[model samples]
Target chain A: MASTDINSTVETVFRIEQARLIAGLTRMLRDVGLAEELAQDALVTALSEWPASGVPDNPGAWLLAVAKRRAIDRLRRAKMQERKHAEIGRDLDEDRGDDVERRDAALDDDIGDDLLNLIFIACHPVLSPEARAALTLRLIAGLTISEIARAFLSTEPTIAQRITRAKKVLQESGVAYEAPRGEARVLRLASVLEVIYLIFNEGYAATAGDDLVRADLCGEARRLGRILIGVAPDEPEAFGLLALMEIQASRLKARVGADGEAIPLPEQNRAQWDRLLIRRGLEALARAEALGGADGAYALQAAIAACHAHTGRAEDTDWAHIARLYDRLGQIVPSPVIELNRAVAHSMAFGPEAGLALLAPLETEATLRGYLPLYAAKGDFLFRAGRYAEARAAFDKAAGLSRNTAERNFLLKRAAACGPARPVMR
Target chain B: MRVMVMVKATKDSEQGVMPSTELLEAMGKYNEELVKAGIMLSGDGLKPSSQGKRIAFDGPKRSVIDGPFAETRELVAGYWIWEVRDMAEAVEWAKRCPNPMPGPSELEIRPFYEMADFGEAATPEIAERFDRLREDAKKR
Candidate 1:
């Protein structure tokens, strides 16, 4: 094989194996940062050797073996520093004699636990949100620094520093390499779910970019959520999150048109909607509810999504049920976003005037002032009520606030459709 | 039983930039829809052509060519391997695929060759080899 082929092949192999290698090594080393370093060392060795000898049949095992060897070497190098080093050093030395089998057994025994624990550790509350995202992507997703930066629209050096500092914080705090139990476990689990969902949300909405969506981020988040469900089968929120994302993700195809214009839910081709994702989402929702998480934030949102999923068209959507679910969601989380959504649902279930009544008061809300969706929702309600002049103004405001080109175009179109401003009858 | 849906590459996809979350979610939902309908076998998006490679064969002389291939319109960005009843069914399913790209995208669906289609061309030896190959594939 040529050098370029070998390089990319090695890269693909490393991408696939790095997470598992690090997960297993973390069990042996008890330090995520050190294990990652050792894994990198193995990758380096593969780049140098695989070209000469060709790729191995079991490349993952080969990389793990090399990483383990590096771990043993490091333990010997740091022998005099701590009793912890001495104990791990002795363990590594014994394991090396029966290397492949023992290593495989160790991997089989705690692979799931180790991966789940690593996720919690990466998302430990001690770190900042940015750091948690970078660390989680690096460890679990096996994304390169540049890849993470590109995905998040940040620079590589910035992401690199965030990851480096995050690892330092984990080591300095002496965080355990196992999932915490009791209330602490619940809190950590929430943080883990938050980080993954945040990643998915960013990809879905793209807060600042010109584009309306980022499929890669959503894909990564869904993949991570699925992994979490596999590793923590009993966690209802894990199921809830997967269900929520699945239902939301299912609509990605019909969200925009050929001209890159935003297609509102009512305008989207319901026939184009992914029924498989809807089914999986509904199944997940059932699982979450069966596990007694029906009132959970993600589960509630999933229930809301299910309302849309069950409909054959926008008109068939159970808006009243959705409004009730949003009410429950508001009681639990109490955000303006939820209120706005509830208002929209009320408008659909009740009347445009009712929705407008709720939205009118929110105009004075500090949080709603700069929120684009608020104005957009208001515009929709007004348009439905035949308050064209007001609707046009609301849509104009929405267009001004939006960063996405497609969304701005759609909003502007809505504003234009409202037609010439009418003179006041008074 | 199977068809391949090839999503032609666009300038944006060729550049390695990411798609927005909205599109991803929509496609994810669409994929779920396909799966729920029992029409989808498997699907995936591909990295840009710069990360790809091709091999040209001239009678036993094979040559490797790294990608960033010039024909953006002709290049494939991603594909879906689907299981459907027939070519018409495959085309119907293709019609339901999301735009895939923000501006404009195209999906070309082609039926896979079935052993039954070969008929008299399928000698006993060839059939046995095909059976062995399918069995081997299942092991993986």
Candidate 2:
């Protein structure tokens, strides 16, 4: 291989190894920020040495060994500084030596646990959601500051500062560097799942961006979800979350029109849906169900998506089954969003009157007052019921509330289609 | 984006020879790593070309061709569709793959063309036309 190929190869290997290196180091040093720095130090060492020496047989192990040595050197220097300042006893040195040896012995073991602990720490509820996302991408995904910034559409320095502050908060709060147990484990796992889902949604549906979907964030979140499943294989909810993401990601292509407009599920070209992802998702959903997660929020949602996946033509969708699933889901999660979806499903399965009846209570809901989808759903039901004027008004309301250019255009078009031969009032 | 990584067929693969147990084990482990990393969407190995058939298309005519095909190097023994951040990431993962054959082999990585790649040409009308064509083809 040429010198440049070797250089690129070294960097690629480092990218693959960095997460494991940092996870193991954090377990040893008990400091995520310091572990990251030492990992970088090891990368630097490899860049200088590996090009000429050629890559090692086990590059990850090589990098870990180098980082461990640097960590020990740093610890020894810090202890020496403390000794010089306070004239500490020799027994302190002996205790430190034993501690180092013990940590070293435990380093190679429980690496999977170490990785899971690192993920839990990164997604700890104490940190702000943005900070948690930035930190997770940085520490767990081995993404650079610029990559994180590009992914989130933020500036490099802002992301760097966010990561820095998150690390400081983690250190000051003194979160344990180990996975929780029993009930605490369940709670912590929820937070981790929430962060991953949030990342996925941020990519799946950009809340505030010119781009409709940022596939990179979705890919990162899916990768993290898979890692979580690997480490916590017994957690049914983890499998559920992975299933949900995979099923949703499968439709990413069909979800948008060629003109960059959002296409409702019924209108999307089903041929574009990725069959492989759908199969993977269904398999994951089965796993979740086998693990007694059938009622889990993500599992239920994945099941609903599967209903659509099973049908080729839109008219062939099992709307009645979907409505039943949504009804069950609403009982478990109890969100207005679920209620709105249930209403739509009911309308499709039964009639527009049924949907309108279900949505009547939501009209008075303060949370749904400004929600664009509620009005859009109302407009569709009203249109189907032949109440053209009311449908037009509802679509107009939805169009007024929408911030996305494509969505607003779609709503405006719907509104125009509602009335007979009248000029649109913009 | 997504890329299809194809393991090119070697003479050994084209001869319908099965992989050794050790090679299969290594490939299985590598696949597990890919899944754990979450890049793999789907993957599978194909039977030898001898068991496959090909269709040839002309301007207005079609002909059927049976394999084993010539040019072993151009044949694909197996393939994986991986969603990656970029081509660089895809290359990194492909480099880590266990060699598919007992002898010299190659892995080719080609990215799928997304709708976005079409720029302004990907209007809804064109897309609908293509969809209609596909539906008609499926019916046939």
Candidate 3:
């Protein structure tokens, strides 16, 4: 193969293997920082050698073997350091000996705990939310620092530092390599789900990109959600999360118009929805409900999604039922966003004035003062109520606040369409 | 095992317009049929031309062109990644697809490359690695 072809193939292969390689090495080394470095070393070796000798027959195994060897070298170096410390009459931590034994036992079996632990650690509460997201994508998604930065629309250096600081914080804190136990387990699991959901939301509605969706990030998050379910089969919230994502992802294909402008849910063609995904989502929701998790936060969201997924046409949606679900969801995890969504549901279920009444109190709420969607929602309700000039002003405010080019243009178009004459509701 | 089913773009698609509710429901039902029959792995619709971009390369130099491309007929409005028994099966399923646009539209089926097509170069060992990778992927 040509050099460029070989390099590209190797890059693809590396992405597939890097997570496993790092996870395995972390099991042996008991250090996420060292494990990542060893994985990168293996990648560097592959880049330098593969072009000359052609790609290996079992490149993943080859990379794994190479990374394991690096682990052995590191163990030797650590042992030497310990010996020197002893010779100098300096005392090392008592846990050092036990760590070696645990690591040796880890090297003997194929277990998935390393990855599960890594997920928990990446979302550990010590790191900032943004840092946790960046680190999670880097370690679990096998995304490069630059790739993570690009996905989040941040600078590469900023992402690199975020990841570096995350690893440093993890190592310094001496975070355990096993999943948290008891009540802590529940909290950590929630964090893990939050990180994955955040990633998925970024893909589902890219905040600033020209494109309405970023399928790569969505696919990554879905894969991670499935893995979470596999690892934590008894966690009903995991199923709830998977259900919510699957149903939302099912609509991704139908969410955009031909010219790439964001199409409102009611305007999208229902036929374009992915039925398989919807089925999987419903099944997951059923699993969650079976586990008596119907009232859980994610399950509640999934219930809302079910309202949309079950309807064949937008007009046929059970608006009153959805409005009730939203009311319950708002009570459970009350936030400005949920309230905004609930307002939309109320408008659909009752009338535009009812929705506008709900929205009026939220206008001055500190948390949503600059939230573009709030204004956009208000604009829709006003336009439907035949308050044209007011709708135009709301749309203009929404247009000004939006960062996404397509969304901004769409809002501007709405602003322009707010003429004196009222259009008939469909 | 896999084929891409492309939805041909029309004038309305180029204009960044949305399909009607009736059309959306018809398409949704058709997609449900495909999903129920286990023919579709995944599918999605595309935004209009104005939201897309193309990169043309000349040697190492590349230039990016903003879309709203002039060629409406050549553009793709949507697509499905389908798994069918054969090309005949894929074609049969395509025939049952609902009209995705208000005006006449086209659906084209194209097969994906299989590992067997690589012949000698796709050694058993190489295939094994891919299988291992796929298995590992599930854990991520």
What RMSD, rounded to one decimal, does every model reach? 16.9, 5.2, 17.8
Query: Would you list the rank order by lDDT, best first?
Result: 2, 1, 3
For all candidates, the clash counts are 25, 0, 12
How would you encode candidate 3's per-residue C-alpha lDDT over A125-224 as one tens digit per residue?
8888888888888887777787787778778899898899989998999887765777888898899999999999888766323332244577667767
Query: What is the Å distance of residue B109 in model 3 from its true position?
Result: 14
What digit string (tens of lDDT, one per residue) describes model 1 on residues B35-72? Answer: 54334646788999999999999998999999889989
Point out where model 3 deviates above 4 Å.
Answer: A1-10, A45-62, A78-112, A207-215, A379-426, B1-140
The sequence of per-residue lDDT tens digits that candidate 3 reaches over residues B39-137 is 456789899989999999999999999988987899999999875545755765676677888888899888977433655565566545544543453
User: lDDT of each model, Cα atoms only?
Assistant: 0.80, 0.85, 0.78
Candidate 2 backbone overlaps, count: 0
Per-residue alpha-carbon lDDT of candidate 2 for residues A235-304, written as tens digits (9 for 90 to 100): 8999999999998988887876655667678777788898888998999999999999999999999999
Ranked candidates, highest DockQ first? 2, 3, 1
Question: TM-score of every model?
Answer: 0.70, 0.88, 0.65
Reference-based lDDT, residue A420, model 2: 63
Classified by CAPRI criteria, candidate 2 counts as: acceptable
Question: Comparing candidate 1 with candidate 2, which one achieves the higher lDDT?
Answer: 2
lDDT value for model 2: 0.85
lDDT by residue for model 2 over B26-90, one digit each (tens)?
A: 99999988877767878899998999999999988999999999999999999999887678779
Predicted model with the maximum lDDT: 2
